[model samples]
Target: MAELNGSPVSLEDLQTLALTNYGHFTSMRVDDGVIRGLSLHMERLVRDSRLVFGAELDPEKVLGYVRQAVAHQSGSFNIRITVFDPALEMGHPGVEAHPQVLVTSRPTGAMPPPPLKAKTFSFSRDLAVVKHMGLFGQLHLRRKAQLAGYDDAIFVESDGRVSEGGTWNLGFVDEAGTVVWPDAPVLPGVTMQLLQQAHEQTTTAPVTLADLPRMRAAFATNTSIGVRSISKIDAVEFDSDDPVLDTLRKAYAGLPDERL
Candidate 1:
């Protein structure tokens, strides 16, 4: 279920969001009342709030709202926190910003599927940095990929430079067995950041669709799926059991969890 602030989501809330849809959000996995990289999640909210809303977000208040929304929850849950101003008008430029925090929680499985088959789409998000509510383009590409019998979509620029996946960050294992991330603009997922910190060999490099053929292997990362190997992208097939992916899985699992 979803709650805006501490109350259940109402039709009025939906209507308000539909008007402008000017918001940013973050999602994470809460396991046994603990979460990995909780601080990073909060930091993302605060940072994005400033960038998108031109206002500061109170991390403590956001945390309180999250705790209250998930108070009765247990076991593993996927939680999302959305920040938006209720009074925001569609095109009004003088509206006072009073950001509201919406928290949603749902039960989740223990792990992501073993691997995924993805296809490349020559599309990218409007503002690639912020995790805003604007997802029409990305979602469209994902739907198209799924309809084509692919697990997901990998977004690439017109020049074939891979930016990220539809919802997750893309990581490639180079021929030298190094975890290389696309240097292009991305949402900078919290899990991806944590993985970089946990693994010293991880580095940022510009990976394009043309380079996939030469890549040793590839993987996708997000809060929902910690690290999922990619079996295929377009006509190129990858090994799911690559040693580099195994190391990445271990690195993500070794990170410390924080109390909610």
Candidate 2:
């Protein structure tokens, strides 16, 4: 982990910290030539920053800086550039925001094995917006899961439908073999949207814990790992021998070249 634009972040953490009081940033994977929905994600970043500072937005400069950072990387690169607020101090809310930008890059860690390929988010004040500092919501969601004796939490809709994990999208393989994931009312994850649109390999549906019995296996998709297989849910574990997981992993792993 290194400080990008002075925002403390892990090399393994999702590459979103660049959006904080730290000016603007960009993240891209070089291994497979995958940029991780560069255009869409950048749009969200600029939109988030504009709303945060009431300033005119231009992500092109930020992206050009990010490309330069990527040039410093050796292999698959996860790069970020953050701008810290020069005008305001940390932990003081409602203060006028003047952010300074920093940029950094690093290789990603070993991906979470199987069904866990997805962005992981913790509950945070930055939930709605992608700001740099929000330790509360980040730790709160993780701790709640630990207290409940589960590996993690799958944020649910008020009506009881499964929405997303703190950082990843929810996906369950139905008894009939259809892979299901939620469509809207949540941040549109890069991997989730792409794989979900692949129809033959995946499909969309509102999922809930009550429907777990119908799930033979489950998985999640994200930019970090591509796609990971989930063996357990809320204490219930499933087959490690599932072949579908391997197939999906290979499918996505092959995507880098496919895109080129």
Candidate 3:
């Protein structure tokens, strides 16, 4: 069940959210009551809430709400927290004093598919930094790629530089065995941040469509998937058994978990 500010969501609540679904959100895998990089998750809420809603979000209040939502749940769960104002208007009159906090939890596996296949698409989001609610463009591109027989879509800039995946960040294992992230405008995902902290060789550099042919292997990172190998991007294929990918995965799994 979904909870709106520590209470069960009612029909009136759904109607209010449907009216104006403008907000920023974060999703993470919660094990029991602990989460890896819990501080980063709270930091994201504070930063995104200020940017999207023009108000500061008290981290303690958000955590209290999350704790309440997962109080009776057991095992791993996919938890999402949304920050928005129910009475928000479309134009200038929509500004609200305090944004509403909504938390929802549902049972889920530990990780997504091991390796993913992606197709390249020419698209970018409006605000690349904030993980906002509206994502029609990227979802549409992903659907189109799925219809064309690909697993998902990877977004590329007009200049041919690869940015990120539809709902994940891309990490490439170069020929030298270094984990290289594409130097482009994209949302810095929580999983990507954790991996970077785990491995010192993680670095950011320009990765273009032309550079894909030279990379030894690739992987995708996000809260839902963790670190997953990228089998193919369009016609180019990568080695799923690459040792570098395995090393990075082990490093990610070793990180300590924080309690809610």
Candidate 4:
């Protein structure tokens, strides 16, 4: 289901986002009536709106629209809140903007997705900090990886530093059991932030594909899939059932949820 500003969304309401694709969005998993990292999600939306559209977005108004969209739904589901202005056209997008909220929901997938076997690609998204609507580059790499018999793709910079997966943040467990987050220009995912807060032994450092062999295990984090183990990346196999992965998963799941 989809709604625009607390009402049903029509084709006209989505034209700008569909055609221009000049907006930012946040995806969250809503369970019952609560959400994990709801505040962080809203903060991302508001912050990205200002950076992408040059306008301020009311967090409370966006939250209200989300609550209204999910109020009737039951059980756990995934929701994406997109902020865009229909009045803004591609020719003159710099004008003062009044953004609107578009909330869409879908059924949640299996928790802890299957272990992923990813291939590395030399690609990085534009505006890596903001979760903007542009996805052609990310998805294209993912498709190429899949066609080559891989589950997904992990982006590596030309300088050989690992950044992130196509749609998630990458995390590593060193031999000493420290959780190492890649220090590169990537989207600050809410789940990754929560894991950093909950996991006591965590640090940020530049991780290269050469450094993967020294690591004990690796995993990916995102809202839909809380923590998923990475079985392999470009032939460097990791123990998908590693004990450290289990600990990280439990740590993330233990985080407190906020009421929507």
Candidate 5:
């Protein structure tokens, strides 16, 4: 995150930073408060920490650290908790803090995409079963996609099948008006799981970019944007203007404050 160009970063600073500033994060959108997927995100942090550091890190300890660090403030934002060998992973020598624990948050901006969602690779770069500090390529790809005039990009593995987008899962209307998602091993995203189970329109299968033109509409699913439609990809416009997208948005959009 330090290389994010003027992005203020601190080691173990989950308390100071909002989740938006951090990639590979878990933000709650369906419910209230900062860090949308607090419980699930915390669970992943503990699980990933142990896998990478071989240290049985406690979620409570991490939470306490965050509370102590940002104890004076209160606000909802995105959250990223990192536990890895900052030295070995980055190949930085003489760094005293190798296996460090870092947590940070960033304020969420306007909620534009709705009903349709995307998951950049950074958020799901590790084994679907493990949430480790790995997915660096995702951060790079998202920026690249935007420069090319796209809001997000879906990940397609070597087999050329679709995965998720930036931080959301991809769902689309096929030529037949059938809604589908190509792959499943998506990291345990709270929003993804909720909608997949709740909605009858959602389905999982192997989709390819070759299938793009046949799509009548496309949207990404996640907690942050809820269900957001996509306006364009590779400058080729897709229909993010479907009524289903709005239906899903009303069913799951809004900030925590609105709920209370």
Candidate 6:
């Protein structure tokens, strides 16, 4: 399903996003009319709208549209809310902005995805802190990784510091079982934030590719999959069934869901 400002989205308006690609979005999994980290998703929309469009977006208004879009849907599904301005042209992007909300939904995939084997690629996203629509570089690397016999790609900085995954945040378990989040400039994922808030043994540190061998376990975090184990990164392997991974997943699943 696709909706724009509570109405069906038109292909003419979608052309703007397809060509310019100057926008931001947030994706979340909704189940039974409720969503986890709904407030965080709203916060991200408001924040990114201001930064990318130089316009103010009301979270309550966005919520109203979201409620309308999900009204007829049942069971579990994934919803993506994209903020963009169809009237804004590429020639005069600096003009005053009027952002529009585009809501799209898709079927949710299997839960607790199978462990992933990621190949490390030397690349970083522009404005990595914002979840913008600039995904060419990341997707390109992911394709290259897949063609090379890996499940996915993990980004690494030029200085050898490990950053993030194609579309998720990466976390590691140290020898002592502490959850260590990479100290790199990556998008602050809502699921990762919720896990950090609920998990007691957590810390932030700079992780390099060379540091992977010292870690005992690793996992990927995103709204769709929650927490999924990473069995390998490059040549280093981790315990996919580590007890710490189970604890982290439970902690995230325990977070209370908010009504949409």
Best by lDDT: 6
lDDT of 2 by residue, 49-143 (tens): 67665565566766665555454445565655555455453456366765445566667866654432222232223443353344455457766
Task: Give the best candidate by TM-score.
Answer: 6
Clashes of each: 0, 33, 1, 0, 35, 0
Name the 10 consecutive residues with the lowest summed lDDT in model 2: 116-125
Report the C-alpha lDDT of model 4 over 110-186, residue by residue, as the tens digit. 88989999999999889999999999999999999999999899999888899999999999999998999999989
Please give the lDDT score at residue 213 for candidate 3: 87
Off by over 4 Å in 5: 1-35, 85-100, 113-131, 175-179, 253-260
Candidate closer to the true structure by TM-score (higher is better), 1 or 5: 1
- Model 6, 1-260: lDDT tens per residue? 89999999999999999899999999999888878899999999999998998899999998888889989999999999999999989899999999999999999987789999999998988999799998999999999999998989999998888989999999999999999999998899999999989999999999998899999999999999989999999889999999999999888878897988
Please provide TM-scores, in order, for all candidate models, with all chains considered together. 0.96, 0.71, 0.96, 0.98, 0.67, 0.99
Q: What are the lDDT scores of the predictions, listed in order?
A: 0.88, 0.57, 0.86, 0.91, 0.55, 0.93
Ranking by lDDT: 6, 4, 1, 3, 2, 5
Off by over 4 Å in 1: none
Give residue 106's error in model 2 in angstroms. Answer: 3.6
Higher-scoring candidate on lDDT, 3 or 6: 6
Per-prediction CA RMSD (Å): 1.3, 5.8, 1.3, 0.9, 6.7, 0.7
Output the lDDT of residue 134, model 2: 40
Error of 1 at 230 (Å): 0.6
Give the per-residue lDDT of model 3 (tens digit) for 1-260: 78888888877766656776688899988777778788998899999988887799999989899888888887788899988876676665345657889998777765646687899999888798989888888899999999999889999998878999998899999989999999999997999999988998878998999999899999998877778899999999999889998888788778997877
Candidate 4 runs further than 4 Å off: none
On a 0 to 100 scale, what is the lDDT of residue 151 in model 1?
Answer: 89
Better of 3 and 5 by lDDT: 3
Candidate 1, poorest ten consecutive residues by summed lDDT? 105-114
